[model samples]
Target chain A: MSAEETVSQPNPIEQFELHRIFPLEINGIETSFTNASLFMLLAALGVVALMVLATSRQAIVPGRIQSLAEMLYEFVANMVRQTAGKEGMKFFPFVFSLFSFILIANLIGLVPYTYSVTSQIVVTFAFAALVLTLVVVYGVYRNGLGFLKLFVPHGVPLPVLVVLVPIEIISFLSRPISLSVRLFANILAGHITLAVFGGFVVLLLASNGWSFLAPVPLLAIVALYALELLVACLQAFVFSVLTCVYLNDAIHPGH
Target chain B: MKMTIISPAFAAESEQETHETVGATGGEAHHEGGFPPFQQENFAPQIVWLIGIFGILYLLMSRVALPRVGGILENRETKIASDLEASREMQAKAQAAARANEENIRLRREEAQAIGRDAQQKIANEAAAQRTRAETEAAEKIRAAEARISAAKTQALGNVEQIAIDAAASIIEKLSGAGVDKDRLVAEYRNVKSS
Candidate 1:
């Protein structure tokens, strides 16, 4: 439960709480715009604005913004090219957008007092589901029933095949769950750990006897913050690299 | 004795439990018992915004940004290619011009050398002609000078011969009382001059 603070202790989960900026509904659907949604929008805008401003001048000699944008473009482009093959370049836009959105969303969440969109299960799951959907759609579209051949491991004996096939199917089914969880859990855990450590400082300082120990928790929070920053970027990269791998599966779908 | 001590501790524990439960219940009632993201109410807007913004980002990337970057990169490639080609052409032109310049200098040098040789030959010919004309004129002057001196000596000798003949005739008339012919004496002086 988020925002579950009690009288006795500071609940770290409260940081994940959502409050609607404007309570909204339509056709009997409650569509309240949330802090989570706000940050998601900010992250998207930040990515778009970066790309637009970088290429706005289109100078032969790139400036800092252009260099960053170009580097990011080539980074994702090369990732798809290497993992998914040249044909995979068709999905470069999708991969770039996903990578940018997740990376920026993760970074922004690291800022104090800002919401972390990728930390939300719904957001990460939505992204995972999108990747899974594309993989299934393209895999089947390109390879037809041959795509199912991916499950049947080659050179395995008939008796051993029974065990391997189900494992492969289960593993395939688990991709989205793992994809979403990896990002969601990493961010959720990092932020919560940071909050838990930070709460100890308040708890220590508030207690007359433990005032001297407040600095200890405060120092721990500092160390955790740096670690959290690394986790933020690492989780984003992990998510992107997995996306490319899944995409490669879609493209090949044979082995 | 155990009951007396345990009762207070039990009462204190129950009271704390009551307070904690009340707070938990109160908080649960307020936000409800779930993760905010899992709450059914928030999903629609999040999904909606996610779709909308992701759509915009995708369009911006595929339609505008990526193509623009590609165009710029391709433009740079062509620019480099054309620049290299132009430089190569210029180099070729420079090489050709240098060759032509060297050829022209060679031609001019050959022409100047030919003119120098011709002028040397012409001066030699003119000097030889002037030397031959001067030599012929000097020999003619020598021959005329020699003829003139010989004629003058002959005339002086004739005058002296007449004077001798006259002197001899006067002596012969005065001393020998005989005068030989002047013509004969002149003839005898001419023979003696010949011998």
Candidate 2:
């Protein structure tokens, strides 16, 4: 390896994980509270507090906070009702909480020194698994063994069953994996890009000449940050809507 | 099918390159690992956390949020229905009041027409009575004038007869005086008559 190349390259992943806030080890199992985890927990609590405070009064003519709260409430509520029907309303609070939590986590990450919990696959996977579990348990509870029929498309030839069933099951199982990876990858890539651009600015300025070229990357980073904000909102919405759709399938399994 | 073969080869090469990059950095630090730290390796805690949050959320939605919204909508429906009933009642009352007013106006007009007819009859009777009284007074005055004229005509005829008789007697008396010697005159008259 060339000396200049070695000097220029930095470990991006290490830099991303440097701010580990808590360290704990117990028995053979060690669980540490990461800065990312801390921020996510705080964001979740903040969302809850804001929702509660905004809705506690229940004014006929809503104030700004109350209006915001109601808009979000109705947004998720309508999504559930439209996708899942009357039975889906029962899932409104869960879907709403999930949406709010993920939304806040994504937005809070944009702040300096705040870690984005959603960038981690473990976090996203957990969210996806919970949704999947709900779909399964609820589907079986509602439809009994008939819930397995979800894997079998109707009106297909019997001879196709052998090929189709396994493919359907694999596709079903892949849902959580894809759902988690989509969110994690998007957030992780955005943050890494921002960091690299920032590092470029630093390196250019430190080199003392040709520093003016740094503005181009800086401008790009700014634009990317704005785009990330939009993505964050979109991803949160997509996640919540998909959850609603999955629950809808569980409630009414045909089509 | 042929393209698929090339795609997998390209993907494998990309994966290998990524691993090599990771390995090259932090050489001894990377080598010292049996597994990455539990923080890095274990996905269990996150799964547990997400499941727990979702479970709590589901319970809250089923128990709390939905019921409140349903109640609000139901209450609004009841309120609107009651308000409509009240307005209908007010409308009915107003219609009844208007009907009563119309009936009163009709009765009043009939009463006024009856009173006008009675007044007109009384005025016509008074005029007829006045005309009859005037005719009676005129006839009485004519009768009294005729009686006075007949009495005056009778009196004038009696006066005219007395005057004529007096004048005739006086002429006869004058002629007799002129001839004082009546007996002598009578002898003479007898003579003359014989002649």
Candidate 3:
């Protein structure tokens, strides 16, 4: 409140952190339900409920909600089929659910009062770990030890295996890290950009002298929000599609 | 094998970029906390949670959502096939009806021709009988007219004979010698007429 305390530049990364509600402590550990987790859970449930309600009363000629439901189904189905072929159908439900969950989470975060779960490393890592687990387990199950052949390069000099194998294993293990980072970074960056633009508009308006110029930042924020909506859906789709591709590699390990 | 090796190499290059970004961000958070900050819940609980979600999702999808969708698709296919079969049956029935109708027309045409032939034969027979009857009746009428002319001719001949005899007697009385010969002349005329 002091006159000497000037307005400082906002830290975009800290702005993205989920603020703890009730600030509860359990055995000296932070056990509070954060806003981000709450919204993420809500988004997941919302997606499930939407799909159920949309498809429950499936008419011979689909109504609008049913058509939308079918569209989402067909979209994910075709993506899987394209990426993994007939083998993909076995993974259809998982991929479709993943796509819907991420899509809904992203869209829900765009709401003013909601937090984006994908912006959090923990949440993204959870999804990435699931994908990586399936890839490893299913790969070995389907192909057995032959799955190890995936690390060995074909038509290469045998001497090069020394250099290639370790690099390949490290790369394989890094799948979850890269997957998680891609989604988390995109969502986090987009939100931060929007927040910064919004802060500019607020600061401009508060200045009063630059009230006329406030519309510029406000317009930029609106445009960026729209862009963010697109990016949100795109990132979800990219994540799901990449998971399918990885599953394809697991099912048929070599080529 | 070649793709597998190449793919991971490509992925690693991208991973390197991500690590660099993470490193940059991690440095900024160093004052608040150390690099690779530990969570309140360790990896074990997080793994359990992940596994739990995966299991539930797997069950929901495999048991519930998949079957519902598959059932809908199967029902649609069955309905379409049944509809198609029903239409095919209708088409076959229509074709059979059309063929029966053509057969009926063919039979009626043959029957009509037979009836027409019978009518013509009946008319020909009646016409032949009428012609024969008329010929016979005309022949009888001609024979009766011939008989009536013959009778009239005979009666006229007898009257002429009597007139001739009377004329001959009168001529004989005009002369004594002729009178004596008139009886003989009339007798000669009667003999000649009889002959």
Candidate 4:
């Protein structure tokens, strides 16, 4: 019984372990290179390779890869235009990069034995922080003190302003936390669940007379993987869409 | 333990303090650390790399890749617009050419009809003139033939009187057995004819 327990210990969380690839101290900061950095680089490079190399021909009639690139471009472009309006196009590059990176990171993580960069709260928080920072900075720079009107919605009764304004502010303050946590938790939970099911298959096969039950967890993992793939894509889309919504507030606040 | 591991939310909360302590001790202790994600030591590196790589990606997208795509799309739009304009112009020109051709056909048909009418009128006039000339010549020839017959008839009548007198004198000579004077006979015949 002890041996079996030791052998089938639910080691699902072990996949998230980060091993430092290159140890570096930057101005006494422990900014060592790790698996997360490698995957982030891969995701960035993947975006660049797709965007840059595919359009090299610049065909009047697009090839398949070029079509894919254009489709992604137009998808995000239309999303930004619809959500944030026409003037919101200035943030197209930022939105595109955020969307593409998160999407690719999620997909790469779905691969067995690959580290999911977006699974880290620090990485997702960095993205959320970046988006929020841009919103506040650009909002103030463009709209000045009127940016605060985002909290003070229009056409509300004076008595309700007391309740509504604080709620809006609290929600506004919670945006980064929610944004970062939503993505991190989704990816982390998906990977953990997959690992858990996968662990079941191993645990079942290791036991006497229970090996026949191994295929059940294996089948469940296959199904869950498909769902996780959908979740991965959905989470990326949600993140970018929310980013656009917040930027819309910056662009056209108060209403 | 199994339930906690399966439920990541619980695991994250329950394991945070242990992971932080393990992070502080560092090195070999990380393998046995609780919930590697919540470990504090990993934040700086991931943040730095996220910033650095994300910055690079932003630059690549904004400065290089995006413009090329926009250019391709804009070029396609302009090409379609220009193509449509050219086709429209061609159609208008073709319509104009067709109209001109129809007009030419109408004019030529009218000219041909006019020529045909003039030829018919000219032919009728020439036929009438030829018939008039032929009738006149025929009538003149018939009148001349009639005049010649009348002259011949007058000459024959003059000879008929002399011959008849000669015959009457010859018969009287045979019957009376006497010679007759031709001059007296002719005078007698003349007086009889006048009577």
In candidate 4 the C-alpha lDDT for residue A88 amounts to 94
DockQ of each: 0.21, 0.11, 0.08, 0.38
How would you encode candidate 3's per-residue C-alpha lDDT over B1-195 as one tens digit per residue? 111222222232232122222242432232133212223243233333334454565566557665665565567678889999999999999999999999999999999999999999999999999999998888888789878877777877766765666665666665544544546776787799799
TM-score of 4: 0.79
For model 2 the local lDDT of residue B1 reads 15
Better of 2 and 4 by lDDT: 4
Off by over 4 Å in 4: A1-7, B1-5, B8-31, B124-195
Which lDDT value does model 4 have at A155? 96
Clashing pairs in 1: A3-A14
Listed in order, each prediction's TM-score against the native is 0.70, 0.66, 0.69, 0.79
The CA lDDT at B64 in model 3 is 68
For every candidate, give the share of true A-B contacts it also has: 0.53, 0.14, 0.06, 0.75
lDDT of candidate 4 over A1-255, digit per residue (tens):
001223546566677888899999989788889988999999998899889999999999999999899989999999999999999999999999999999999998898878999888888988999999999999999999999999999999999999999999999999999898889878877887788777778778999999999999899989989998999999999999999999999998876
Screening candidate 2 with a backbone cut-off below 3 angstroms (N, C-alpha, C), the clashing residue pairs are none
Candidate 2: CAPRI quality band = incorrect
| lDDT per residue as tens, model 1, B64-146 | 88888777777777988999999999999999999999999999999999999999999999999999999989889988988
Candidate 2, DockQ to 2 decimals?
Answer: 0.11
State the lDDT of candidate 2 residue by residue for A52-149, as single tens digits.
Answer: 65556655556787667667777877888998899887777778878888888888877756777787777888788889999999999999988888
